[model samples]
Target: MKLQAIFVGLVIVALSLFFLSPKVNSLPVGANVTSNTSSNWSAAIPSRTDAGGTITTMVLDAQSQDDGWKGYVGNISGKFTLDDASGYSIYDWSFTVTEGEVYISRAASPSWSTAICANTTIISNEQNYFGMTAAEYDIINKTFNETIHQSFRVGVVDIVNSSCSSAFTYVNDSKYPYINESTPFQEVLLQTGTDLIYAALLETDNEGFHTGYTYDFQAIVPDNRTNGVTTTYYFWAELGT
Candidate 1:
């Protein structure tokens, strides 16, 4: 009788602990939150594997419920980086929108425009704000306070270490093999369904303006036709140095 009583007590204790665990305390599966000034929005990175590289995505949305699927209405932001074992140097990066009306936002100042298809002027005093050493960025700030982002939708951004030679090499050299060096990085930011949602930003190396080798944005519109279940927004990234 005592043995059976102890076994019953153990089961009750285990059940109590399981229900009180931190995992159970997480945001309910189908809840959605948003933050414009900060990256407090609900986001996730879906895993993927490929020959060229492994790609990951950081997704954000405002879903009515957490059905482990898509947000009813929100945005997707993805960043790419080199796998430590890949042994690669980032020569260029690109952002492609396969579906929905997606826009990109790279500027810190809210006043800066967030148009994806337009060649907008960037007004900021911070040189290489996205990526660079404090001292090096200071030097650039002292030398040329502001620069222009040439009109580009897909292509390479110039490296800071080289005398604009790396951009030419990546664009012209068959070994490196890249396209549209004219497409500026600043122009890659996309616009979303619920205004321009900017989060999941990756700073570049000291020698580069951005850390991410590539960035892709996919905005999935809410599906009203379904039985209140929205499809997940797809955000993908291909990592390289």
Candidate 2:
């Protein structure tokens, strides 16, 4: 897989949390639920959605992310509401990410493109970095020059239930955990010993240094360039319960 040398700061947010490894598990017979780097093929849900729960603060756990700046740290935080006969708030929701993905698609309801994933698969710098090892990050950083602003336009991976599948729209899938939606998404690489996180970005202590960004969940996603701008990438997660 070819990668561009462009740099992007860390970014994370709570859109539709949950991801990484693809696996299906048995549940105790109930409705589906939601969850998030939780990327290590592990389905353990450390947190869940509460009544009108909102993760306003975001703090990057330095211990988990000891690699330092490679991607932009962002908070895609939001609440889930049911569209039943009596619009109500969800409760006691469990979180799970079966064979899935979190897409960084176009802003508006746009056509899915393979190139968008490549554009967003960036070489995150001090401003941002994620889901990669420090050594791997250093190699990429050393290889690509900061001034070399270019585009890879490689395309998307062939994941089972990802945006790559033209017919696999989350809004139409009954198994999708969080409040279903119609959005584009974003994928990845080698390195088994490495801490390749595609799940949720664990938050750390505010300790005063990190303010406003102290969110419940966070992750370093691709700064897509399909449209020649990073602002166009939209965060969408697919969950299973």
Residues 1-241, candidate 1: write the lDDT tens digits. 9988888865534343324433311110111224322122455655546556656565755434422212212233333332223536344344432322122233222222222321122212112232333464222223222232232221222222111111111111122233343322221322322232221112121112223333232111222233554333333222222
Off by over 4 Å in 1: 1-123, 126-176, 181-241
lDDT of every predicted structure (CA atoms) = 0.26, 0.29
lDDT of 2: 0.29
- Write down the worst ten-residue block by lDDT for model 2: 164-173
Cα misplacement distance, residue 27 of candidate 1 (Å)? 30
Best model per TM-score = 2
* Best-fitting candidate, scored by lDDT: 2
CA shift of 92, model 1, Å = 37
Query: Candidates' TM-scores?
Result: 0.18, 0.23
Per-residue lDDT value at 241 in model 2: 22
For model 2, the stretches where C-alpha displacement exceeds 4 angstroms are: 1-82, 85-87, 90-92, 96-100, 110-158, 161-232
